[model samples]
Target chain A: MEEKNGATSKAGDWRSYERVLLPPVRDLHRLEVYEQNGGYEALREVLTSDKWDPTSVTNEVRNSGLRGRGGAGFLTGLKWTFMPPVDPNIPRFLCGNGDESEPGTFKDRQLMEFNPHLIFEGMLIASYAMSITTSYLYVRGEFADWISLMEVELAKAYEKGYVGKNVLGTDFSTDLVIHKGAGAYICGEESSLMISLEGERPYPRAKPPFPAQRGLWNYPTTINNVETLACVPLIINRGGEWFADLGSHRHPGPVLYGISGHVNRPGVYEYPTGMLITDLIYDVAKGMRGSKKLKAVVPGGSSTPILRADQIDGVTMDAETLRDAGSMMGTAGMLIMDEDTDIVSWLRRVTRFYHHESCGQCTPCREGTGWIENIVTRIDEGAGNLRDLDLLIDLCFQMEGRTVCALADAAAWPVRFTIERFRDEFEARCRPSLVPSGGVLTPALGP
Target chain B: MTDFIKDPVILMPERHPEPVFSTEELVFTAEETRQIATWVSQYPTADGAIMKVLWMAQEKFGFLPPEVIRLSAGALGMPYARAFGVATFYTQYFKSKKGRYVLDVCTCFSCQICGGYDMLHYLEEKLGAHAGETTDDGLFTIQEVECLGACGSAPMLQITNGPYVMNLTEEKIDALIDALKRDQLPFFSSVTLPQDEDDLGGNRRTDVRDTLTYSAPPVAKTLG
Candidate 1:
């Protein structure tokens, strides 16, 4: 388990590095351009190739060991297998989650905007694998531009007979539908995404009646992230083994890391999933914005716990590796903060996001997210008492596993981590001098 | 001094009554009807057309008044209660009147640290309207949002009915507002607008990859 920073960590050998989704070409948003540059080749192969049925395609993916790129690294094959036997009498469906609402994440938008057909090819493969002849791509509102861009590309695909009846001159017919989501982050969650498609309030549903078992108008369905589905075509085009061999152990294949914040160059970097955090920020991102030292990093999306600069050393950028380092690679959206950052204020803003996003489904998340934000806001405003420090962690603990959705857990991570790892930073900002006379602190300190 | 639940914007956004459509019968023009029909054609079940139908109504009549919601409900073949529920639940839909120019500032963690709050204050001072308040002349409204998924730009604001302005500074804000008010929005923010307007169209990449890269042994050679 040897680890190194910057230059040495990446090992220069990019021979296996594959950019299936994001290619280094411009004007590819148009169908003609995309087709010219090897787009839709996988779908054409799948339709016209020899003896490749649903089970074999699923087996190829299973062998590839491709995990869901959407936060939970669940094996795509295993999840697809979870679907109850589809009654041919009733239609089964597949939904692509284009609801890129996760804060600190923007990879999906880039993929869809630039290479829309890649998503379509991926959907075509997925539809074949699960016998899901009909598919829907769900892009949320406020992303009207994304909806517009996807619509244009989808039209071209349909007109070319790539999608819609008798695709590529085959008996199997697959139709691709695009669904627009109203502004709701919870809808990005699979269960909620199903409900949103049915034109309902975007509240996440309970599991056990998982979408795979019964989804979208009470039929069996599978929902995957936009990036996850976009990878399917690649898996089909390239051999699964070659795809699996693209990354470090455990986390395999190329991933789109949306690196943002105080870095000199904040852009999406397509690389193997397990690049070191230092390499992404220092080498690939070209270093911090100014002369300031790196202080903290949210190695995943905003919901993930912040890793102190020291903790980021040798930390590979993947789900298992990040989880081993006490954070989940939920979206791989690294938000970098510099030394001059006021950590308490930053955490307060983070808490505010979860508070705003909590769907009010369960009492704990409904109440606890706002409670954490309030306490953190109090601390940032120079009123946090020593006991309030414990209060923040306790509130987060109560909220973690008690909610219907993971939004509660997302809210809890930043609070618990900041209190546990950066207690001094919290203490430095807990200005007892600003605590009201004979108020919130009087009972704890004296009586 | 309790702030456990005192966030006005989070708890209650500034609301205006449903009057625009109440004053007259809500009707879609032939063009709007054709657009709505096109969106409906994409879905197998018409229920999937609700969001897009709402988008059509909003486009025709700036904000989604109750009457417009009703029209969208009818267009999607869903009940009015269901359409209202969908409309009220999401943040993008405007139930009330909005200024001609709406500025939705993303104040989430990534944006906050990178001068999002500063931009908020500057907008408030310049517009004389806080987050959710429309200016007297009905020119501008500043609203707060969780995130726009543009964290790569740090602090950013999306111009409603227009494009997103990213990596914003105070002076840039002034220049943007000037161009916007003068109705001469020249080429400014590359983060939102199309790349070349001719060739590489639709939300082109703005910043180049500036992070330096380090090399190690090949991933396949080392791990495989």
Candidate 2:
């Protein structure tokens, strides 16, 4: 058995890296098994021990080089530091985002549904570090099963004195509430999550008054991903130095990659932060479905730009490498597509999701997504002319970086990247079949 | 760059369930009010409990009506208009009365490739109702929505807004409809929540663990 060091990958074989969060054990969901496997031991140690203070916890996290496992890989400890000093009258909170709605992203759902106590334990330690008493775990509305599973686990935690006031007979206390989102993808965003939590529409709020400053009823709040918080207890149990040396120096720790789409075996896998794309796709996920030639991979979630197979041949699946390769490690979704996929039809299907999910708050996203959807649909159905292709490119540029939220940019990337990488396919599919005169299929200019 | 697509891109304009209106005021029973009171205690403010109040109102009333929204507002000590805003905004809350079972089939990118459309088409043929229409028998209403994050088990459906039976099949749908008609389905509430026992899915007990919970160790922990 490994010593379970957090720093420096003793992982001679990356496949067997430290299984801090997603340990491969059945019945680990049981409280007895979880406690036996060193679960909640960190939280108990932090609250009961004299050596580790709240500030020390924060500093350790900073040193660990942990980044947010949500779309944006922001430093986890740095995000905690953003919280304003505790105001006597004002309150602070830690929001655990369980609303995993990204199309190809199902990693959060795994943690929330299976080993839910990890999330609860992580939230308790996080709340303790920030000196906040209350934390809310927001699961997606459609994830009713997850909601139920969490409810059962939380009841166990409270009954055993892991959560609720005076956890484990310590001066520190914590309150964790489970919130079910009401079927909105935008609500996954931190501000939009706050809006939904407030019993309102889940529209992303503008920045400057970020959640760290004035969040959730105008108080300082830190919103962390389900995967991000799930890593906290593991980082706490082993020292920060141990965690920092676990993976890549820049973005350290284990990463949960959700592989779906055209994979022979589609499921979530956790690996050291800087594993190669080929290993994840071929070795870990068992290669493409039907053993077909790999065409493209959405290195991150569908939001990040797509990476053509050629570009990702030797690339590592980390934030920096994917970014350098014209993609991102957005949630590490890693959707696989085979050579037989119709790029045009795929783009049409992909673009329509953005259009349908647009919050209708920002002009560019509200209007631009619809435009892209219309044009792509026409092209896919052979109703578009050559003008539609250039028009699609123009629309992509206009919508990117032009919305109130990053969703517009996320909405724009796939459209631009799909066409950018597969222009020939889109062109080949362009033929006059059922060209609607004035609707989505309408040619922008004379054909 | 393209003025062509400037036209409105409304999605599933047909998905809007017609409002179920009644001149009579909507009210909750004593038990319903009592159960919701427990949730309200957990929230810092009454406003925060609106989702629970609305969910309970829907669970009890079958669908959220204008009167029920107003009634929920009163229960939560929130303005009726605010409750209306929330009920209207979310896709989960149905405005009109649906058939006894509302079939929400997911047609997102993940589900689409895995014969999700075939399931929708099959349901239309089986139930004699289109995607957004209720059957004349008042047994089922059908509609399509985006991803529910259950991609691993694609071609899934949330049976009448309860348990999500994934990796869907025609045979399963037939059995589900039969059980639903007979009010004999068990997994939606019993196993899914261990609370309601409303016949959606079975409860997950260590003594009776679901087949999905595997004995095989996860790949990451092996091969070290």
Candidate 3:
């Protein structure tokens, strides 16, 4: 993918060849305007038209290579394919992840808030594909308006015959309900979400009986992120080939790259995955918003490693390249930090959030994130011995991929990366205070 | 919390003799009410549908006012406090009063890392009140919220009545505020095919194909 360096008279600014994602200024967030602007048409088509086969819809998405936009970047279609074929005789479910709790990730919230109809359309399509009569949009508790938006639109959908039984006058039918989570980050994970939806403690269940085969009341179900569902209609309308052309084969389709940090044009830029980091960082965002020097960027939200200026070049906002650089695009949450920012303090803050949100279900994450938080906090507050650095690093290693879910790993990854790439900084910050104490030995290093 | 959770609304036509109010503060159109009833009937018991019904009522009415909550409670055979607790517990369901348009700023960890603080500050200044406080004009209210899940676009804010403007900047914030002030909300592109042409006002007769074809593709617009 080619990158553009500067602005042009043409809307041709970001890339010589890129389409402005979901264009045309509609009512800022009103469902009425959404209706006026061609929202729910695809769903109307699928429900009302003769060609409403759910299998072909799933096939089109599978061919599109559109991964889950919420985080993890897993293939959306592949996940849907895992659904035990929906038997109308049985009850199957689809839960939309409105729980956008991942640190440095907010794309799902945006998708629902701005273009709620997109999710409604996606929900209907998925329900139609999976033959699910009942679907739920488990929106985060914080999006007060979005929940309302979903309600209004849902009401409209039913009134218009786009939802409810005999949808669009077809034999197939699905009903969508918007459920709200009580402000918990852990709920973003599928099993945890299922647990919460089932009115239990928000604890994750063991997988392989993954949500697809056995989920939500122990029935076969499909749980998807808001963005993943939002991408469904596009794949159906534009065809898989056209969708694949947007990003790389490995991570195809247009990704909503949310550029932040000290950039002038910080906003979500929808583009193909392979767009070069240098072009995105400097040109598209117009560099750091203030005069702050670019120090590092937490490449795919806080869960991914922190990348310095040198690493910015050649980086692609896709899964494989991000992994090659020793980071996963856990969620396409790119948080940029400048030289003026304090990395230690930043990590401490992020760690604190994770600690508070640990859910305490797993011993590793429940205890591990808490320990990391204490060490990082001590380090940030300028009361740490050099030995504390290694201790924190060791805890991170132990925590990675060890828990029942990714929460522990999400908390540990940033700490691990910060220590490895910026150990000297951590050491320098800790040593001066320690030297004054005349300590004979440092703290033990391993966890 | 227990009571609110048990019964999400207090007003109902059956349980209580009178309507929730003499006049509807947030009147639902006949069509909108029918939509609500359709969902209400889906529950095995009327009380089971209280949470969703209140959600629909709160949405129809700007805030879940006392009357509305009571009405919902009565309708669902729920305790008033139970309805209140459910309404208050979920941040999405507002408990306090609000302006005609409320701007929910995303202060989730991701947005915080991505200039969310600055955005909140900017909105506070623009709205002339701190978060959770409505503006003097009563046209707008600004509040900070946890993740709206647009992590990709940090520093974003939801103009209560608008989409999530991600990768947000001060300039974008300014434009959003101005647009809200002018009631110049962004359009929402969708199609509505009424069950019957006569079900709604004559407004239900547009061709979705023509309207959708002329509209910009889904990815082009903002997600609030």
lDDT of 3 by residue, A339-391 (tens): 76667766776787788778787898989988898888888777777777767
User: Can you give the TM-score per candidate against the true fold?
Assistant: 0.88, 0.88, 0.71
Worst 10 residues of 1 chain A by lDDT: A3-12
Model 2 ranges with Cα > 4 A deviation: A1-12, A431-447, B1-25, B186-209, B212-224
**Stretches of model 1 off by over 4 angstroms after superposition:** A1-18, A431-447, B1-18, B22-24, B34-38, B184-224
Assign candidate 1 its CAPRI class: acceptable
Error of 3 at A158 (Å): 1.7
Candidate 2 residue A231 C-alpha distance from true site, Å: 0.2
* Descending-TM-score candidate ranking: 1, 2, 3
Error of 1 at A128 (Å): 1.2
Ranking by DockQ: 1, 2, 3
Q: Per-residue lDDT of B1-224 in model 2, one digit per residue for the tens?
A: 78877876765576645546553637667887887788787666778889888888888788888888988999988999998988987888888889988889877766666567778887889998999899998988998878877665666788665777666678978888888889764363212221112222423344433433111111111000
Docking class of 3: incorrect
Interface RMSD of 2: 9.2
Query: lDDT score, residue A241, model 1?
Result: 89
Q: Write candidate 1's Cα lDDT for A1-447 as tens digits.
A: 334333234323543454566765566678888889888888888778885888888888888888888787788877888877757888888999888888888878778866788888888889988988889898877676667778888989999989989888888798888887767888888888888888787788778788887898888999888788888888888888887877665667788888877777676767877787888888777788774699999987887888988888778887766787788888888888888778887888788888888888899998998889888988888777767887777788788888788889888988899788889989888755334443233444531
